[model samples]
Target: MKKILILANNDVGLYKFRKELIRELVKDYKVYISLPNGNLIPELEKLGCEFIETPINRRGTNPITDVKLLWRYKKIIKSTNPDVVLTYTIKPNVYGGIVSRISKVPYISNITGLGSAVENGGILQKVTLTLYKLSLKKAHCVFFQNKENEEFLSSNISIGNKRLIPGSGVNLEQYSLLDYPKSKEIHFLFIARVMKEKGINQYLEAAEYIKKKHPNTVFNILGSCEEEYEEKLKEMNNKGIIRYHGMQKDVQKYFRTAHCTIHPTYYPEGMSNVLLESAASGRPVITTNRSGCREIVDDQENGFIVMQQDSKDLIQKIEKFISLSYESQKGMGIYGRKKVEKEFDRNIVVEAYINEIEKINKSIS
Candidate 1:
């Protein structure tokens, strides 16, 4: 049986975005998973794959430690000796890409997001881009979640085999269209990492302003958080500006309840999973005009696109939605669900991976 090595930064990410793909691949290949240990390990192992606990500092930037990570990846891949290696996220795409190349193994990479280090564009971006250029040079294929991301990386580095998919593509079946909450009050949802880059402050500011004008409405926040930001989000939740549910496993409940999804992100993203999931759950999205964020929205068709980092615009957009009748708002959500079904179905992503793997296999043969 053909063997495949899957390397990533976190098990949660692999579970969230790549689980469908992993399930489809495992039937035909010997799947070996390498990632930092987390809650998803048991589920992953249950799917008949070997899981290796590889400690990774996902947000760290020490040069010495990063170099050591590459060494560790080399060791792991050397011992595993998989026919083809597939990796996702920043560290694995870069570090694992390099290791696979050194081992003379074909590898595929999914650029999930451009972290703050590269998105901020300073010395960090320079060093990171250099690493990307070196690592992806020999990759079998480089998959990007958005065109904007693909164009940005291509401009910085020469990636030969590149394919674009819509933000990992949501599973339409898994996230079925759900009935709206029975509450008479309107609800808006903000789901993303609780970080400044994701416009957490803007979300809070808009929530405060909108809630003041429209006392009957409510705003909800969800997703994981850093300690520094978690306290602030919790404080806001306590104050009743926005109800923050930190690190939710199932987000469809929030989506089913929301009249609209708000994602005013300023960070460079491969694509926003929150936007995709929101749309898949049959809810409209209001996000920034930023690259990855805008792909899910059609600006007044499915949802509105607010100005990035502009709290006032975010407030205005939320107010405009409030002005619309419930029926009209529901139509917007219906349109969003249709759009995701046509363009962001998980089957498309699954087939793409299968095709890519087959292409590589034939080439090797």
Candidate 2:
């Protein structure tokens, strides 16, 4: 049996997004995963795969610790001597790719998103891009979640084999649509981490504007709050502009009941799981005119796509949805569900990974 090593920064990357792939790989190979410890350790262990703990900071910039992490990962690669190394996220893809190259191990990487590095465009962006170009030079294949990222790499980086997959696919069966509830009021939902980059403040501003005219409409937000924005969001919640449901485990419950999901993110995203999940749950989406977010929504079809960071445009779109008849909104939701079935099903994504792994395996053999 072959040995495969998976590296990621977060538990979701190891446990949720790659669960089916890991299970399938373990059937024919010795599959080992390395990630920072999180809530999913028990679940991952239950799947009969080996887990290794590693220190990975998903945020912040520290030169000394980062150098130490790179060396530690290289040592692990030398010890594991796996047939292939699969990695995701920025730090893992860059550092892990370098380690795999040095160990003469075939490897693949997924560029989940450009992240704040490229979005902010400072010293970090330059440093990360340089690292990516160097590390990915010898990769077996590089997968991107959106066209923008793919185009950026092909044009800038020297990577040869490249592919695109939909953002980590949503489980369609689990996100099935419920019957549209009859209510005299309309509910708008914003589901994401409480970050300024995610357009949380823009959503709040739009909600405030809309509520003054459409007093009966309900605006709700569901996600964890970062310390920077918690106070501001809480103040808006107190004023009844938006109801904050912080860090929910079961967002599907809210999706089943909400009229539409609003994601006016200014940040670069891979493919937004929230938008895909919302659409799968039979709800329309209103997102920004950006790469990953725009792919899931068709303007004026299933949902609307407003200019990024434009609170006024967001408010207008909200009013447009509110003005529509209940039946029309339901129709939009139905269309969104159909879109998910056709394009963003979890099984489709899993199959893509299977195919990629098999292709790489054959080449190496």
Candidate 3:
């Protein structure tokens, strides 16, 4: 069997979002995965991937660490001698792309997001754009998660071949339509890292405002705290404003009772997986008017769209959800499920990769 090597920053995202693609690839290829060690290694290994314990400082901007990562990718590519390389996230995509090009290997780069550094422009953005242009100029194929990302890269850099995909696409099977919850206490869920860029403060402020009036309503928060919001989150939890369930492995359980999902993120996302999964699970979403968040919502149809960074607007939308009758809320969730079924199936993403890999194989032959 031919070999396909994968490079990424973390195992959680790879296993959570792209496990289906990996499963499909393992059936026909010897899949090698290089990423930072995490909880999902055994699960990925079970899917027939040879795991390479790669150390990557995901948030650092140190050039020395980046050089080490580049060196590591070069060594992995040399030793594994894979037919093709697949890279995800920023560090892997940029550094891994360079090594793949120099080693004469066909590689596909997945532009997962522009990230905060790129989105919050500066000298760093210019440096990042320069690196992306240098690295992705010769990629076999570059897949974008959103149209904005595609347009941004196109204007800023020269890419040979690029395509847009549905932000990694939700597994329709895994996130099957759930029964809309039937309860007097309206439950709203927030599923993302606890960070300002993700609009956690907006969610918290809305929670505080909404809880003051609707005492029976519950606001739930899941995922790890990436920043310094733990104390505030805990205080809110104690005050019965929101329930902070830190880093849940099984969010579907939480989804079972959630009436709606709120994602008020301002981050430059390739796509918002949380929104996609929520919609797939037959729960309506209320998110920002940003690219990744807006694409999934059909404003007052599947979910409401709030203005970015405006807690007052978010509170108003939450209040709007509260005003809806139970039947109307359920109808909104049903609409959301149908929307995901039509547009964001993971099989579409899998098929795209398979087709691209087959084309590369044919060219090699």
Candidate 4:
């Protein structure tokens, strides 16, 4: 059987977002995954992936640590001797791509998102773009989740054999459509890390302002607090400004009661999985007018697109949603569901990977 080695920064994201592709690959290939050890290892093992516990400082810029990671990828690639290497996230994509090229192995890379370092621009963006250009020069194929990311990278680097895919498309079956709620109290959900770039402060501010005027409205926050916002979240949760459900494994239950999903993120994203999942669960979304977000929303049709980091615009959009007639609100959700079903189905991503890997395998054979 052919061997496939996958490298990523974290296990939870790999399992949560790309499990469909991994599951399909394991059936026909000997699949190995290298990522930082996390709670989801047992779950991935159940899906027939051999997990290689790799220590990765996902956001750090230490040269020694990065060199160590490169050495580790070299070791893993040499030992595994896989037919094709697959890499995701920043560190793995760069370090792993470099090692794969040196070892004369065909590899595919997924530009999931440009991290804050690159998106913010400055010396860091130049450094990162230089690294990307160096590592991705010899890649067998490059998969970009959003056109903006693709265009940015292409303009900066000489790339080959690139393909665009929906950001790790949502599973239609797992997030099946729920019945639109009939409650008079509007429920809005924010599902993402409680970080500054994710527009948490904006969400909180909007919640505070809207909750005061529409006292019956409910604001819900889900996902882990990766930064220093835990105390703030707790304080707001206690005050009834928002209900914080920290890091949920099953989000569909929350979607059941949510009238709409609000993801006011300004972070550079390849695609916003939260928006796709929310749309798949038959809920309308209100998100920023950025690349990852704007594509998921049809302006006034399926959902509203707020200006990035503009609390006033986010607040205005939230109020507009509040003012929507019940029928119109539900219709927006219906439209979102149809849109995801047509465009963001997980099967599309799975098939893309299969075809790409097949092409690589046949060419090498």
Tens digits of per-residue lDDT for model 2, 139-242: 98888899999998777789888888888888777778867757877889998888889998789888888889999888999988889988888798898888
Least accurate 10 contiguous residues by lDDT in model 3? 226-235
TM-score of each: 0.96, 0.97, 0.98, 0.98
lDDT by residue for model 3 over 1-365, one digit each (tens)?
Answer: 89999999999999998899999999999999999999899999999999999999999999999999999999999999999999999999999999999999999999999898898899999999988987899999999999999998899898888988998999998999999888989999999989988999999999998999999899999989975898898888999999999999899999999999999999888899999999999999999998888999999999999999999999999999999999999999999999999999999999999999999999999
Best by lDDT: 3
lDDT per residue (tens digit) for residues 1-365 in model 4: 99999999998889998899998999999999999999999999999999998999998999999999999999999999999999999999999999999999999999999888888899999999999988899999999999999999999999989999998999999999889999978999999988999999899999999999999899999998975998898899999999999999889989999999999998888999999999998899999989988999999998899898899999999899999999999999999999999999989998989999999978988
lDDT of 1 by residue, 1-365 (tens): 99999998888778877888889888989999998889889999988789988888988888898898899899888888898999898999999998899889999999887778887888999999999998899898999988878888899898899999887898888888877556788888888888888898898888878778898888888888867787777777788878877778778767777888888889877888888888888787889998888888889988999888899988888888989887888888889999999999988998989999999999999
Ordered list by TM-score, greatest first: 3, 4, 2, 1
Those runs of model 1 whose alpha carbons end farther than 4 Å from true positions after fitting are 229-235
lDDT of 4 at 143: 93
**Residue 177 shift from truth in candidate 2, angstroms:** 2.1
Cα RMSD of all models vs. native, in order, equals 1.5, 1.3, 0.9, 1.0
Q: Against the hidden true structure, what lDDT does model 2 obtain? A: 0.86
Give the CA lDDT, 0 to 100, for residue 106 in model 1.
93
- Is candidate 3 or 4 superior in lDDT? 3
Computed on alpha carbons, the lDDT of every model, listed in order, comes to 0.87, 0.86, 0.94, 0.93
Model 1: worst 10 consecutive residues (lDDT sum): 175-184
Off by over 4 Å in 2: none
lDDT comparison, 2 vs 3, better candidate: 3
